[model samples]
Target: MAEGRSVSDMDVDDVIAMFPKIDPFLIRKWHYAFYTFFDLIGNNVIEWKDFQSLIDAIGAVRGEGSEDHVAAKVSLTKVWKSMTDTMKKDVEDEVKSTSSWKLHVHSSKPCDNRKTEKVLF
Candidate 1:
């Protein structure tokens, strides 16, 4: 791990060295996904505020107070809750660093088609 830098800040070789058991392709994919989806504020970590911003953006497009907006909020809230619960922490204190997020991704078995199908369904 690079001093004062998260895994997201590291190069491919650094990430591979940090997590040798994980696939390099998966790590690269995650690195892309993390920046593209999770890091809404351009920060290296994923926090509740980022999810709230996403929820707000979706609500704005769907129309706040509308059924679709409400449903989106509920669904996103559940997702946030699931993440925090998995880490055994409160929502306000929850912060998904690159290493922790990658570990969670690995534990979720992203390579398993059955699990992926279940999530998609």
Candidate 2:
């Protein structure tokens, strides 16, 4: 995490293992940080893969059923819902401009509710 920490001088697992020996609280903190980072990267990667597969399938749209359309639309919604308001509009704009994947556009408008809005992303 330090500036100019050479990759060759580091082994992430080794630093992570040092947590328990250093402090129990430090271990927990390390775990929380790592898990959050891991989950973020994992989710991004998964969604990217999902979009890639969906795009690959788009070429065979002749075999696509109504459910396929619904699923694609829902995927768009799920992805957009995961972003912030500023990014949400950017995504929606991109979706509108991308002619090839117009079939996957979602209708869910990001809302600014008075309650129950938590920062999931």
Count residue pairs with overlapping backbones in model 1.
0
27-106, model 2: which lDDT tens digit per residue? 34433432342223333222334444554465358345556655765764565445324234444333221111111111
lDDT (C-alpha) at residue 17 in model 1 = 73
Per-residue lDDT of candidate 1, residues 20-81 (tens digit): 89898877777677677767876778788877888888889988878988887898787677
lDDT of 1: 0.70
The alpha-carbon RMSD values of the candidates against the true structure, listed in the order shown, are 3.9, 12.4
Cα-based lDDT at residue 1, candidate 1: 56
* Total backbone collisions, model 2: 0
- Candidate 1, superposed: residue stretches over 4 Å from native: 1-8, 107-121
Q: Give residue 89's error in model 1 in angstroms.
A: 1.9
Clashing residue pairs in candidate 2 (N, C-alpha, C atoms within 3 angstroms): none
